[model samples]
Target: MAARPDKLVIAISSRALFNLGESHRVFEEQGLQAFSRYQIERENDVLEKGDAFPLVEKLLKINELLGGEPRVEVILLSRNSADTGLRVFNSIEYYGLDITRAAFCNGESPYRYIGPFGCNLFLSADGVDVRRALDQGVAAATLVAGDSRKRRDDVLRFAFDGDAVIFSDEAERIYKREGLVAFTKAERASAQKPLGGGPFKGFLEALQKLQAEFELDSCPIRTALVTARSAPAHERVIRTLRAWDIRVDESVFLGGLPKGEFLRAFGADVFFDDQPAQCASAAEHVATGHVPHGIANVDA
Candidate 1:
């Protein structure tokens, strides 16, 4: 096989890739046997779209522009057994999704295989798996179920959090430990210094490379920085991106304002944040991914 070191590989869980809420509830309430039977019975039924559906669909479409040689690859990484995964594969076929690779760990953590898969990003509904993936230096996000906004096929919009996502969690740790005043002072003091890179930095860099394939006016990918930090805190983020030579088409400094309406107006295909509350809020308006990183995710 030829080398594909540059391919953007994305591994997704069955639950995050499809709408399996009822089946999941059955598994939790009854037992694995009952859940397996339910899935087997509904094997022919096409599953509904999940939180990451739009994003995945768009990513797959990016291959079409390259004569279908597949610059992007999507893999199924789920906790279900191979037999139980038949329903997932059936749905994938029903939807005509171009996915041919999968790993059904049968309840074991699939994150351990992320490195072997060379996944640029991992998306799942399981928080524990996401946190573990981040800890292992892989970019992963917990997919929060949400209502998808109207998507523009010609343009794909992505909104990301500032701290603990695109930038390092240093500022976030200070904020979590100290009060707002200390965090603000620290950001202002380090305004000239570039912030450290976080988990999603490589993914953003890859997207930037993809963006370069088209003109600015005609670029298919549009990225935004939608963060809660305002004014002085924003300087560090700007300088950080400048130092890294990354392009952000839009930026919203909310200053603690709710992000749902803003994300709706941006018509984002997906949004990512480190905080659970922010993800829940964004989920109300658009598909949201919870980046489980930094002090915000530390267990008590």
Candidate 2:
């Protein structure tokens, strides 16, 4: 067996892995029994691709560049029970994905198993599950609808939010409870202290390790920090990344500006943010993931 030192493990849910909007609608409108029956009836039907499918396919293809060493592993962590999950497995086999591990949680949140699997990232359509995973200090995102662009076989670009998505939400909590003034003061006062790691820290580390394997000019991955923090608040973010030794190719501190246009211009493969408003806006131009974490999602 190949060594697993540099492996990047991603856990994905059924709905995020494939286009199950119709089936999900059935489940929402009717009930679990109807949904199970529907899935069983359409067991052989190949599911259409969803937003995260292209990203997963591309990540898996990266292994081919590594001489088939299997540097990436994608696990299916779904809320569907084993009986109703046959359709998803069949679809995976039909697509020829190299995914062999899976967990059918029936109605439970699959995030509970992410830690046990040592997954670097988790993508799901369930907001609650994503939030739970984030609270548990795991890198997780709730995938939302986005522009259905065809997948490219070139470089992969990842865009991440600042608070709660990449770094901890301490400043975000202050910002939420107080206001921008108090938040800025808090950040400036603590400029020297590196903020705590957020849910996506582990995933970033994995990608950084992968990036190190290749030369800078020829690296297949590029990362960006697209945050709403600006000026004085930006100092803390820079120090935090520097402290972590993570390389960010691009940094855009928008200072509360709309991020949709910038994300569109960047041509990101996927954008992850904690705020739903930003995710909804970015989804207009590019694929977006909602990280339901930190103070922004405390009420939700």
Candidate 3:
């Protein structure tokens, strides 16, 4: 059985939650000492919102919608040490975000603490941290920086890719290795065989439970499956969802088309895809999360 899904917890990197382009550049151009000094000196400078800021805001609002029971929590995970991360915490206070806990990892990756934190989802700017989190079977993605905005309604929209993200890359591996024809044949033959759940499955399950807290017509969260599969190739996807007993507000089978415009039309708060090309294309129009899993990300 899947884990309980009553509440949701998110682990987000400092760079993903707020704009750290300048600080990151310092670290890249100079070195750790220069980066530390830069952060410490600018401790009072409030950070700007990053690509995943809107999504994080919406996630926190769920607790407000639920009469402040704190059903959702956002934990900060950063590469900065406690001294340097003070600015980030100050920015959180300035923004009035409800985030309270954090892990200041000095100059190391902060992915190791996600398990202890019981995070349902992990979003980071570093692909390395995101991949490490996903490898531990936690839902993780690298937030793509872009100019995407939230929908007009209060609903939090989440869009996901099919293979290597929501579902295992079994079919994708077949397609990548043998070709589309063989993949189609394989999927059609195994349409009834449920695909293994990927890293995001648990997070999706928790999100569904959260949605159940509100009425369907007035729910504040909406989800979509925006994939590059269409027609006869879509059967296994439908069957897979049915097998999992999960519901998606929308499912678009693009069958190899670009996803940016479609995501824009859907007003997605964020879209997660395994392919960097797709993430780049989607980031052109919507907030995107690059899930570095499966065969498409073999080189990543």
Candidate 4:
């Protein structure tokens, strides 16, 4: 396994930091009645009256679960132009969370690029922006959790789909483009052969390095592949993984079934795929992410 990085970097969108209910409650409790398009737009004004407490609590809890004291960096991006760091800081102090550092970026737009720094997770309250970022190559958003040492790296399981995730999406594209007949014929012929490259090729290599660095026996990172392609298509998946020398703790070929049940049973920390329907359901059950297939029009 490769050496584990000393710290994990996380850039969190402001809305993602606060739970939906908490944010809404904060707006109402402050009595900041200004509304825009029938939604509260002046909630930021209430921060001076202590409406940012919930957001702070949520941040502290996230820091706790991620391991306290220099383990994580929380970068908050807000849509409000006013500075809310002082209130956010006071809330962190009140919660007694050991946050090594924190930063806030204020603007009317919540969308921002936060990558190229090797952040393990990039979270946003706006699902649309999250999707766009994933399509643009930023995968793995952090899951919101309460501050607790028990959940820190507790069975850090990662789940992924077989097609497109580990193997190239070529076969799936053929199926989609030319229909099932050609796809099946191609799969049968490629049985002993391996699929082409995948979106997670580098990530897989990193995980292998991580596994070796931590020692596979007591490794904190575990991986699973849950795909809908079964039987004949399974061989290529196995061969591809073997050729890459990457170890997957669990692999399930569900053969065209919804992956929600399996993902829930696996208790994955994050699951990645290229399909929205799959991600939409998986996100309801776990910390799910979408990895855009390069073959497709990423900009589209």
TM-score of each: 0.94, 0.92, 0.96, 0.66
- Tell me the deviation in Å of residue 121 in model 2: 1.0
RMSD, each candidate, Å?
Answer: 2.2, 2.5, 1.7, 7.0
What's the candidate order when arranged by decreasing TM-score? Answer: 3, 1, 2, 4
Compose the digit string of candidate 2's lDDT tens values, residues 101-171.
Answer: 99998877788888788777888898888877766666888887987464454677889998988898999
lDDT of each: 0.87, 0.86, 0.90, 0.57
Best by TM-score: 3
Instruction: Give a tens-digit lDDT track for model 3, residues 98-188.
Output: 9999999999999999988888999998988888888888999988888667676777999999999999998999999999899899998
Question: Which tens-of-lDDT digit does each residue in 222-281 have in candidate 1?
Answer: 999999999989998998999999989999999999999999888898899999999988
Q: Which runs of model 4 end up more than 4 angstroms from their true locations?
A: 1-8, 20-82, 85-103, 108-113, 131-136, 140-153, 191-197, 292-300
RMSD, candidate 1, Å: 2.2
> Can you list the residue pairs that collide in candidate 4?
1-209, 1-211, 1-212, 1-213, 2-209, 2-210
Cα error of candidate 4 at position 25, Å: 10
lDDT of 4 at 81: 30
Better candidate by lDDT, 2 or 3: 3
How many clashing residue pairs are found in candidate 3? 1
